[model samples]
Target: MMVPCALHALWRTLLPVSCFINSVLAAYDEPQGRVATAMTLDPTPGKDAGPALPEAFVSYAFEFSSFPDFAGNSTSGPNLFSDQLLNNIGNITGTKPYIRAGGNTQDYAVYDPSLPVALVGVIDPERQPNYPTNVTVGPSFFESYATWPGARYVHGFNLARSNGTYGDEDLLGPVEPACRALGIDDRLLYWEVGNEVDVYNRGRFAVRPPGWDEADYVAEWLNATRRVRARMGEACPELATDERFKLWAPSYGGTDNGLDAVRPWQDGIDADGNVVEVSMHFYMSGYGLPGITLQGTLLNHTNTAARLAPHLNVSRALAAAAPGVPYALTEVNSLYNAGQPDVSNVFGAALWTLDFNLWCAANGVARVHMQQGLNFRYASWQPRDTGLAPKGTRPPYYGDVAVASAVGDLTRAEVRVRSLRMESETDAASVPSGRGEPLP
Candidate 1:
């Protein structure tokens, strides 16, 4: 049994030198297969084999302009755009909020000396001339916010037809100047080149009227974006990563925005373009607005989710054009028809809002704009206070708070979901807006 030399011939033969080495190698390759202990694991612990968004997802809502520009005026008489309003804004809305100053005002391109002033319904070319230039970010430039609870900015690009769509009044000039004047340039988040162009225009520049084919639309948007970027340089920078400026849209329905305006802005690229958002809009359900419940808010929301699914893939359609820009539901809420009881101000709305947000996050959307004008304005979402002030913290608020919390746990969570089911019933007492039971 005790072999003196290195190994006796018979012992060596039985040992099979390579056998021991092979066993060691096999054990080293997949330690888990043989391990009986509970804790032994692979050394790599920090890497993920899944999708992920950044740590925090910022929130964006809007307040329209109610300021009057009287040259010698002392804006002291309960100005629609007041300090109290800004103060209240910080209260109702969350921190890092964005304001789209251009939506209702439009009038980009040619700076008009005469256009209707915000909230006053009076035209004054001398005061609020160009759509983009009319609204100021306030004197303190929302710097007043460091003292307040939370406030941020995301300026809207003027798409109003009062000025020609392709005019060159701005190389992003007016907005940059206003923000710089207010010292809010550093806080500025995004610059929407246009809004709801899909449904708004037949083609080309929606206002220009010659109209746009798919190719022309993409080319024009790219050109406009490139021009704006040329002006922004290293000073401000693109929001390619930051939560606020994720570009949000042609903003059509799942179909073209009614006038066959699909895939245009998303179809072309600029020579010097850095698109980070592909935007869209939706407001599908309500009892009397479209005059179709389809089912109820619950069924409506489920259908809306299905309806929005194909549209969310605009990022894919944009793959060749903008390459890296992601998707965003930039301007959205429950109903396009504000007067509707079931969808506009109902409990069902809360459920619908919550579901839509979950759907977007679940489906890989990068950002969303709840489209609020809570305070008074031409198109205030709720219209309680002046558009300058913030309001609406119930159902929309529920969506806001709940979605933020839900999305927090899912920093790019790609949970394997089987299917979503919902049942909506209009029984007349389920909510104050006079709808019925909602199933989710």
Candidate 2:
């Protein structure tokens, strides 16, 4: 399942990032003695084909603490490397990739006006070395949002600080500043209150008690979001309308982890009807989980389908309950815990990236945000040179560029994607077929 040496050399020359077209054509080399399977892509839309996707369908989610590093402030200037990479995709897809500045650290962040630096964080290696556990952001942190031109963002607020209690002013302290910073110039796409609240009852990062359930989560969410909306109304009254004042809700880790995905919807998580989209987080496998291999897990089309089935089901149920509300995989990547070292950073992951995104596009997921960090093994590119890694494109980034190319110019016409069924999960032809017009 490793990328052939010939293709590896081609990936190295993709500095301009537009060379994905040439590299993708030579993406696969058939193994000896393997039979080629026929895949018939019907022009007619199937029962499972999703709606026309947005122009910026493929996007990214950065670790909350690393936002300053990825998007340098006004003083240090913008990260030209990041802008170049994003703009390259925008050239093909007709829009720059949207950036979501949130992850585990988002819940841990607190605002401090006096701090000189954009952010000051303390990383506990035992919990997670990829990002900080306790994060503080100063007034300069808002400058990072202004760095990336033409890119909309979903700013995450501190939800975990409430610590299972509602109406905690400390938790609401960051809302006014964030609203004032991003509410202008249409730069804000949506506001996310938390990251993966479903797993807050257990694990090393648990913030809620053992008895906490979906109902408790719903109550807390309603209270906090209502207060957030009221604060925004006072801070930025112009953005308090139905058209703009929407939030990405629940931000669950999975369908059936500590909390069931559908239960929150049933519990009236969106009682105010301001929830514009449903957000979910996913990973193909954990970093040190057993029986995980690039070939059997990441590159296996069947495995991808299996992993996505539950999420798709949740999406379907949400559509039934709240029609027209889009569902997105706001936080997702190949492996959790900053990804596996060799398996996630290699060319095989590039192949996995294509299959994963195409499958999601065809299966009704509204958007897919591949999660990344400063030195995460599965990052599309290392934003800066650190002791652990260098500042350069990784193998998976080629897959991202190829996806943008496959999507083509969305501004010209509506795009519909359908996965062509394959006889084998390991078959190289298991890619989706996309059309520019609505399928009849």
Highest-scoring model, lDDT: 2
RMSD to truth, every model: 17.4, 6.9
Worst 10 residues of 2 by lDDT: 2-11
lDDT of 1 by residue, 41-143 (tens): 2222122211233222334444334222211123323233332333343333233334444344433333332322223333355533222333423233222
C-alpha lDDT (0 to 100) for residue 21 of candidate 2: 23
lDDT for model 2: 0.76
Query: Model 1's lDDT to the true fold?
Result: 0.41
- lDDT tens string, model 2, 1-440? 11101011111211112122213322444354756444333445445556677768889999989888888888789988988998998898898898899999998888877889899999899887778898998888888888878889999987888754544654677777777878767788998887899888888668888889999988988887888888778888877778888899889988878787878888998888889888999899899999887767775555677788899888988888778888899998999999997789998788778767766876778888999898899999988889988999999899898777666666665666654432333233122221111211
Worst 10 residues of 1 by lDDT: 1-10
Superposed by TM-score, candidate 1 places the C-alpha of residue 108 at a distance from the truth, in angstroms, of 7.3
Flag clash pairs in model 2. Answer: none
Error of 2 at 412 (Å): 1.6
> Positional deviation of 131 in candidate 2, in angstroms?
1.3
Clashes of each: 16, 0
